[model samples]
Structure formats: C-alpha cells, structure tokens
Target: MTQLTTIVISNVKAADETDLCISIQNMRLLRILSIKVTNEEETLQMDALSSPPPNLQKLLLTRKLEKVPQWFCSLQSLTYLYLHWSRLEEDLLPHIAALPHLGRLKLTNAYVGKQLRFGTGFLKLTVLWICNFPQLDEIIIEKEVMPNLKSLWIDSCMELKIVPMGIEYLQNLQQLDLTSASRELKNRIRNVDILKVQHIPKRYIWK
Candidate 1:
C-alpha cells in the first residue's frame, strides 16, 4: 500500500475513520485521494489523518467539515481540490490560497459566510469555481492575487448582487460564467459592471 498513488473511498462511515487514516498514512506515494460520505450523519474525523500523503496532487471530499484541517497547509503539491457540503462558517479562501501549486479549486455548499476574499498567494492558480453559496453576498479579489487565473465560475449564489470586487485586476482572466444568479446581479454586470469584465474573452450569464 506504500506504493499506492490513488485511493477513492465511497460511502465513508464514521466508524471507518481510524482505519482510513492508518491506510492513508501508509500510502506515501499517494497523489489522488477522494472520500465521499453519503450519509449526512456520518463524520469522517479528517484530523485523524495526522500524516497525510506528502505528494498528494488532487483531493476531493464530499462531506460536512466544521472547519478546514490544519494539515491542509502541508499539501505543497496539491493542484486540484473539490469540497462539497463542508458548511464551514469561516472564510476558506485565506487558508487554501497559501497553496503554492494549486491550479484548480471547486467549492459547492462549502461555506456559510457573507463574503469570500482572495488576497495574495495563489501564484499558480488558473481556475476557480464557487457554487451553492446561499449566504455569500460578495467576493473580493485583491489586485495581485490569482495573477494567472484564466477561468472563473460563480453559480447558485443568489445573494451576490455585484461583480467581484477588483475582478478588473485579473488581466489574464479569459472566461467568466454566472449561472442562477440574481436578476439584479445580471443586470449590474450587463449595465454597471460591464467594464470590470470587458477584458475577459468569454462571458456567460444566466438567471
């Protein structure tokens, strides 16, 4: 198992956390790890993974996490990450932005905050997706953050009534997609915020 590079666990149960952690710790070569907990009552106890795979490049977790793990700061090789139903109340952007090699990120119903701010440090990130954020009202992207970002998708954020603050700073942004957004948001984008995303080569907006 030490030579294993990928592992996918479906229907994960609370009782399996201990064994799962032991198995993952032994897989030093693991590059991809995906865990899905189908039952809402089941908790993965992710912190048990004290020694996560050092070289993991992709990770997908479909479960509820009260908070992002402190160990996540150690995944230097991580490039792709997907989180669903975490329902964390904290602003997750700061914790994951420090990842030096993260290129793609997808969040679905992961946060319960009013705003998500992207400060500096996503040097290699190119793609980002934010979806199913029922309470999110704003996203702030700082001037130099995500300099290489190429594609951005924001869907099902009904309360987000304005374009992301400082989106105009992403000179490399090529595509922008908005789906199931508020009518005011779509109107603001087409009328008031048009200049903010004018440089983007592709734009799609759907109510």
Candidate 2:
C-alpha cells in the first residue's frame, strides 16, 4: 500500500516459510523488497524469487547470503540492488550489470566469481559500497561507465591492493571512506574526501 519503495528484513529468526510466502504474496501490490539475513535456509516452496513481483524497482539484501543464484540477475525491471556478506561469483557481477534498468549497487564481502567478462554498464550506478572482502586486490573502474557515482565506501578489506589507474575517472565521487586497513596501495586518493588509516592520529592514549 506504501508503493513499498523499499523493504528490509533484518535478523528475523522468525522469518520462516510463512513470512516468505506472505512477503511475495504481498509484493504483488508493492515495489521493493529487502532482507538482512543470517542464513539462506528458507523453505524453497515459499522463497521462490526466481520470478518476483515483476514490478519491483529496488531489492536490497545483506548479511550472510551465499552465492547469488542466476535468477536474480534476470529481473528486467529491477533498478537498484544491494547484496552483501557472501562470496559472490565474479562472473555474476557482470550479469547483474546487464539489468537494463539497474542503476545503483552496494556489494560487500563478496568473492566476485570466476566469470569476469561483465561490464559496469548495467549499473551506470550513482552510488557504490564494497567492504571487508579478503580477496579484493583492486577495484577496476572503467571510464566509459559509472561516471555518476556520488559516494563509495571501501573498508576493512585486508587484501585490497589498490583502486586501479583512473581514480579520477569517476568524476562525481564526493565522499569516500577507507578505514580499518592494515595495508595500502594508493598514495593519494584523487580529488575526493577520503580517509586513510595511517594519516589519522590515533585517538587512544598509550604508555
């Protein structure tokens, strides 16, 4: 009834089959769906999102999800997505990129699968966030796509080495937060408001 522009379910141990069935049953009259999960063990008979509301515009999910099944990337009307806390196949990232209306994305703790041929074109996104992934070496930003990003959060990623060659390519990037890092790969973070770990003085008093 709210046009349901957004819906997020967080830490609902009670998010059982009935809840899933009812949510989808509810989506027929809504526009968005989100779930913050601790596990992906919902009963299949009820949690079939392979074909969703068909009118959804935003779908946000976070926390402890496994590899994203391909059915998710096939949504033609989905324009915004947020997937966090899993080892996402790299190849699938590009598949999500192909959603014709996809516009914004936020990925954290993902494994970006074996298939790497995808493009950032699907998101031509205006905002992005990636955090705490141990395998990320560098983020590859292509100039021809994603020029509208306004904010990016890349944090707690131990293996992340650098932020590619054209840090300046994202012309509109405004707020960038890079924190809790033990190693760094870039000397300057272009022309943006960014925080580097070593540069900030430690706040605690130590003997």
Candidate 3:
C-alpha cells in the first residue's frame, strides 16, 4: 500500500517469494525494509524488486546475498544499513559509500573480500561496526574517506593483524572499539600501535 512505511519479512518460503516481490513494489512510501530468508542456499533476488522510494532511510538485508543490488545505491536518503551473513562475494565498501546520507553501518560476516578498502566518500557516515569476518586480513582507508566518521568497532576477525592503516587521519574520530580480537592483535595495538589512534578521545579493547 502507498501508505505503508515499514516492512519486515523473515523466514520467507519459496512459495511466498512472488507475493513479497509484489508487496515491496507497491510500498511507495516505505521508509524501512528488513528481509531475512531462513534458507541459506536461497538468495532473495533483490534486483527483481522495484526501486525503493526516495525517502526510504533504513535497509537491512540478512541471509545469503551474492552481491548488493544496484538499486541500493540509489537510495540517497538511507541513513542506516546492516548486512549480516549476506554472502557478498565482492568488495562492498564502494557500493555502500555511495549512499550520501548513510550515518551508521554494521556488517557481520557479510563480505568475503580479503581486503576491504574505503576510497573517498561517505560524507555522513559516523559509525562502522564489523564482526566475525574470518577471511578479512587487511583494511585500507584512503585519505579523506568517510570524512565525518567518528567511531569504529572491530571484533572477532582472527586474521586481522592490526587496526586499519591511515586511521590517524580521521580527525573527527572519537572512539575505537575492539572486542574478541586475537591476543596478538591486542598486544600489537596496545604495545606498538597505540600511537596511531592515541589521539582519539576514547578506546575500548577487550581481549
């Protein structure tokens, strides 16, 4: 319905896929949409759904997604995004940075990339949280990316050896949070790399 502003669908079965597709396309005023399929092998074909409304602000997709749907980039008004276990087989940072208004992002075992890079733009992003990504070994942040980013959280990435490089340049950064990281990583940050983010207003680390 045109007046519908929020829709959340979970445990979607194979037979109900068609109906969900139709319902999404008709929700012209939708501002929030969250979908999680119970079957890990089945992907919700987001590309087949109609474009979200210009005012839509929050999107969460959990389950097995091969890649982000292109329409997600067109949601210029999106402010919050969470993708968990999405099965993204490519670098998703570039796609996410295109959201002009995005302020918060959380990714839990969502990306398969060994190296996650953020190049130049996420004008409004303030907080980023990532967890449980076993393959992630490096995070690269180029100069001037996410200019307004204020907080960063990392957890349970056993392969990551250190905090992302170039983090010192985030002038607005206020907090750095680390949890469940490998002991070696904790020691590395505490003993050797503390200077990199020492200027940050707050830091929380739990080994």
Candidate 4:
C-alpha cells in the first residue's frame, strides 16, 4: 500500500472515514485518489488525514462538504481536480487557487454561490469546466488569471446572464462550449459579445 500510486474507492460510507484516512496516510506514493460516497448527503471528514500524500496529482471527490477542507492547500503538485455534489455555499476558489501546477478543474453541482470570481493565480491552468451550478448567476475572470487557459465549458447554468466578465483578456482561449444555457444568454454572446469571443477558434452553443 505504501507504494500505491492510485486508489479509487466507490460507494464509500461515512463510517469508513477513519480507516480510509489511516490507509491513505500510509500510501506515501499515491498520486491519484478518487472517492465517491454512497450517500450524497454524507460528508466525509478528511481532516483526520494529518499528512496527505505530498505527490498527489489528481483528486476527484463526490460528497457533501460543509466547507473546503483545509488540507487541500497542501496539494502543491495537483494538476487536475473534479468536485461533484459538494453543495458548498461559500467562495471556494481562494482555497485552491495557489496550487502552482494546477492545469484543469471541473466543478459539477459543487457550489451554491451566486458568483464565482477568479481574481488571480491559476497561471498554468489550461482547461476549466463549470456545470450544474444552481444558484450561480455570474462568473468573473479577471485579467492575468488563468492566462494559459485554452478551453472553457459552461453547462446547465441557467441563471448566468452573460459571458464571463473579462473573458476577452484570455487571448489564448481556443474553445468555448455552452450546453443547456439560456437562449438569451446565447444570443447575448452571439450578438452583443461577438467581439469578445471573436478570437476563439471554436464556439459551440446548445439550447
């Protein structure tokens, strides 16, 4: 187990948190860890894992979390992260933005916030996907943030009124995908924001 590089645990129960943490603590070489809880309403207490695998690169978690775990700040090597059904109501970007090597991030039904603002950091990110955000109405991507981003996908965010603010700053963006987005929002992008995304080589919008 100490040499394990990847572990995927599905249908995890809340009762197994302790033993799971203990097992993870022993996997010093673990690089990929994915855990999907059996009950979406159950929150896994991962803070007990005092020393997380320092070399972890990809983490996918599907569970209910009251807040972003404090331990996430230690994943300096993480490049890809997927969070589903976290249902958090607070600003989550601040906790993970400082990850120097992070390149891809996917959030599906993970937050209930009204706005998501990417002010700085994420210098190496190349792909970002935001989906199923029930209450999200706005996303602000400031200049100099995620400068290397090449693809952006927004899906099922019905309340989002317009394209991300400062999206034109991403001169390197090559693709944009919108699925199940409101028609008005789509029209806004095609009509009012045409100049903002004209540089993007590929744009896919679906009703």
Candidate 5:
C-alpha cells in the first residue's frame, strides 16, 4: 500500500456528524489534512484525532467547528492554515501567533465576534487574509507582532468602518488589499488613514 501524505475530505454529507477522531500519529509522513462538510447542520469533532503526525504542515477545516483542536498547537512545523465557516467563538489569534514557523493564514466567515486582535510573536508570518466576517468591526494589531508580514487582505467585512489599528507597526508590510469594504471606510483610507499606511509599496482597493 502506498503511504498517503495528504488527506482531504470535502463536501461529504454528514461528515461533521460522524465521530472521526482517528489518530494519525503513525502517519509520520502526513503533511496536509483538509476536511470540509457539505451540511452546515453537521459538525466534526477533530479532538478525536490526537497526536497528529510530526510533519503536518497545512490544515484546512471548512466545517462548522466550535474551536480549533488543542492538539493542533503541538504541530510546530505547520505553516499554512485556512478555516472557512468554522464559527469559532473564542479568539484563536493568540494561540496561532505562537506557531513557530507559521507563514500564511486565511479565515473566511470563521469567527463569530466583533473584533480580532493580534499580539506579539509572529516572526515568520508573511501573508494574512480575513474575509466574510460580518460581525468583525475592529481589528487590533499590537506592535512587534508579525514583524515579517508582507501582505494583508481584508474583504467582505461590512461592519469594519476603518483600517486596522496598529497597521503602521508592520514595518515589513508591502501590500494592503481591501475589497467589499464600506464606502465610508474606503473614504477614510484615502483621506484620514493615508498617512498610516503610506509606507506600504502596494495598495489594492476594490469597491
């Protein structure tokens, strides 16, 4: 039997209702695992899968999970993460920022919150994207966080009325991409917030 390094389950009906906590610790070569359900009513309890493979680098969850599995924090080699419509209530940024080598992160309608804050210690991060989070009105970025970040994208956040606070601290940032933002927010960026991100080399704004 050929050893499988990547496993992806997408659009599987009732995938979330199934108890799929299989242990993959023996799959030492596994690097990517993605599970996406077709029905929003179903949920997957990934906590059943304890002790992930050491080489796991990318994890994508498209189901309606409440929170990220604690076991994920142990995957030090993980670099890219994408969560779509996970409906997480708690802020996962703090735990995510602790990832030693994480580089890119994308969230689409994953959070059920009004704000998202980024603290310190994202040394290797270079790209970030957040989209379709309706309740998210504010984003706070503390200084020294994501020092190596170069590109950022925010889209379809209708409630966000202004640019993220502390964006100026991303000294290495080169691009800021915005789409489907409120008109007022766009106006502020062009007028009131221009100086805040004037240093960035590229700006892409789409109405």
Candidate 6:
C-alpha cells in the first residue's frame, strides 16, 4: 500500500488466484482499478496490466478479453483506459505510448482499428473512442504524432472502407464521430483538413 488510492476487484475476482495477481503487485498508490474477471475460463492473462499503473490513474476492463496482456508495456502512471469487448490489438500502441500522462482512450470492440501504428506516438492522447470495430480501415488523425489528440469516435466500423488516410495530420483535433457509417461509407468520405471539426456525428443525415 504505497498510499493506495482505490481498488475494487470483484466481478467475483479470481484470476485463478495467481498469487492474487502478485498481491495487487504490491499496490503502489494504485489510483483506481476496477476489474471484474467474469467466468474466467482461463484466457485472462494481464501479465499484470503490462506492469505500469503503479499509480494507475483510472483503468476499467470489463468484459470479453482473450489476449493483449504483456503488462501493457510498462504503464507509466496510466491516465485512463476503458476496454469493453476486449480482444485487443494494434500491438497496444507501444503500451499506450509509454503513458506520458495518457489522457483518455476507450475501445469498445478493441482493435485500434488498424492504422496509426505509431511506434512511439500518442504524445499523451487526449480522447479516442473506437466502437464496434467491424475491422476499422480509416479514421487516421495524426498531427506529427498525436500531439494531444482532441477527440475521435468511429462507431460501428463494419469493415470501414475510407477515412484513415493520414487524417489531416491532426493538430489538436477537436471532435469527429463517423456515427456508425453505412451509407455507402458516407459516399466515399475523404475530405481531410479538419482541425476542430465538430460535426460528422448525426450520421448519414440523408447523405
């Protein structure tokens, strides 16, 4: 208990008692961690959230996860990460860019939507939420490497066909949510040049 903050391990917590996850990894301030290991039929190997979260800011891993556990690349005081239908990928983005005060990152279907293979990027991601990844193939926003990405939400991927083409090199991108695109992939969306874009939400509003 290095001044432990908060930890609630009870989705009936039982990672097969692997030493109780190494005794909460000797809790070091442990900012706030909520895990609910449901029906763990043996696929949950966090390797200890990839060994970071020492003063873990806020991490909520809920349901359905099969892999992506290599101790999350040494979490350096992880800011906030919420994973839903976890089967995580995108190599976990160098363990979330080495968590230099990570802002907020959320994944519903969990895939990183494949792209932004930032090999040391995410200069402290702002807020990114990727939902229902049907195998993302677009939504690429990077301003010389995530210089504090503002906000981006791509909903219901459905094999997303065109959006991630460098994404205007995001310069503190404001907001973008494809709104579960499907209208022929929003009639070939490829307009780039968005910095503080606020719309793109009310999906397919009659194209």
What TM-score do all the candidates reach, one by one? 0.96, 0.67, 0.94, 0.96, 0.93, 0.35
lDDT score at residue 192, model 4, on the 0-100 scale: 94
lDDT of 2 at 156: 68
Error of 3 at 7 (Å): 1.1
Instruction: Give the alpha carbon lDDT tens digit for every residue of 9-109 in model 6.
Output: 65534455465566567776678887766554434455543355467788887665566666765667788888876656545666567668878888787
Q: Which stretches of candidate 5 lie over 4 Å from their true place?
A: 11-19
Ranking, lDDT, top scorer first: 4, 1, 3, 5, 6, 2
Give candidates' CA RMSD values in order: 1.2, 6.6, 1.5, 1.1, 1.9, 12.1
> In angstroms, how far off is 107's CA in candidate 3?
0.5
- Which residue ranges in model 2 land beyond 4 Å of their true spot? 1-26, 38-47, 112-118, 186-207
Q: What is the lDDT of residue 40 in candidate 3?
A: 84
**Weakest 10 consecutive residues of candidate 5 by summed lDDT:** 14-23
Model 3, which residues run further than 4 Å from truth?
13-19
Give RMSD (Å) of candidate 6 vs. truth: 12.1
C-alpha lDDT values of all predictions: 0.89, 0.56, 0.84, 0.90, 0.84, 0.64
List, residue by residue over 65-162, the lDDT tens digit for candidate 1. 76787688888999999998888876777788889899999999999989998977888999999999999998999999999999999999999999
Model 4 C-alpha RMSD vs. true structure (Å) is: 1.1
lDDT of 5 by residue, 1-207 (tens): 126789887665544332444535556788898888777877656665677778889989886876777776787999999998888887778777788989999999888899998977778999999999999999999999999999999999999998899999998999999999988789888999999999899999998
- Report the candidate with higher lDDT, 2 versus 5: 5
Each candidate structure's count of clashing pairs: 0, 7, 0, 0, 2, 10
Which pairs of residues collide in model 4? none
Which tens-of-lDDT digit does each residue in 77-117 have in candidate 2?
87777766655543446667667777677776656432222
Structure candidate 2, residue pairs in collision: 88-111, 89-112, 89-113, 90-112, 90-113, 91-115, 97-122
Comparing 3 and 4 on TM-score, the stronger one: 4
- Candidate 6 lands at a TM-score of 0.35
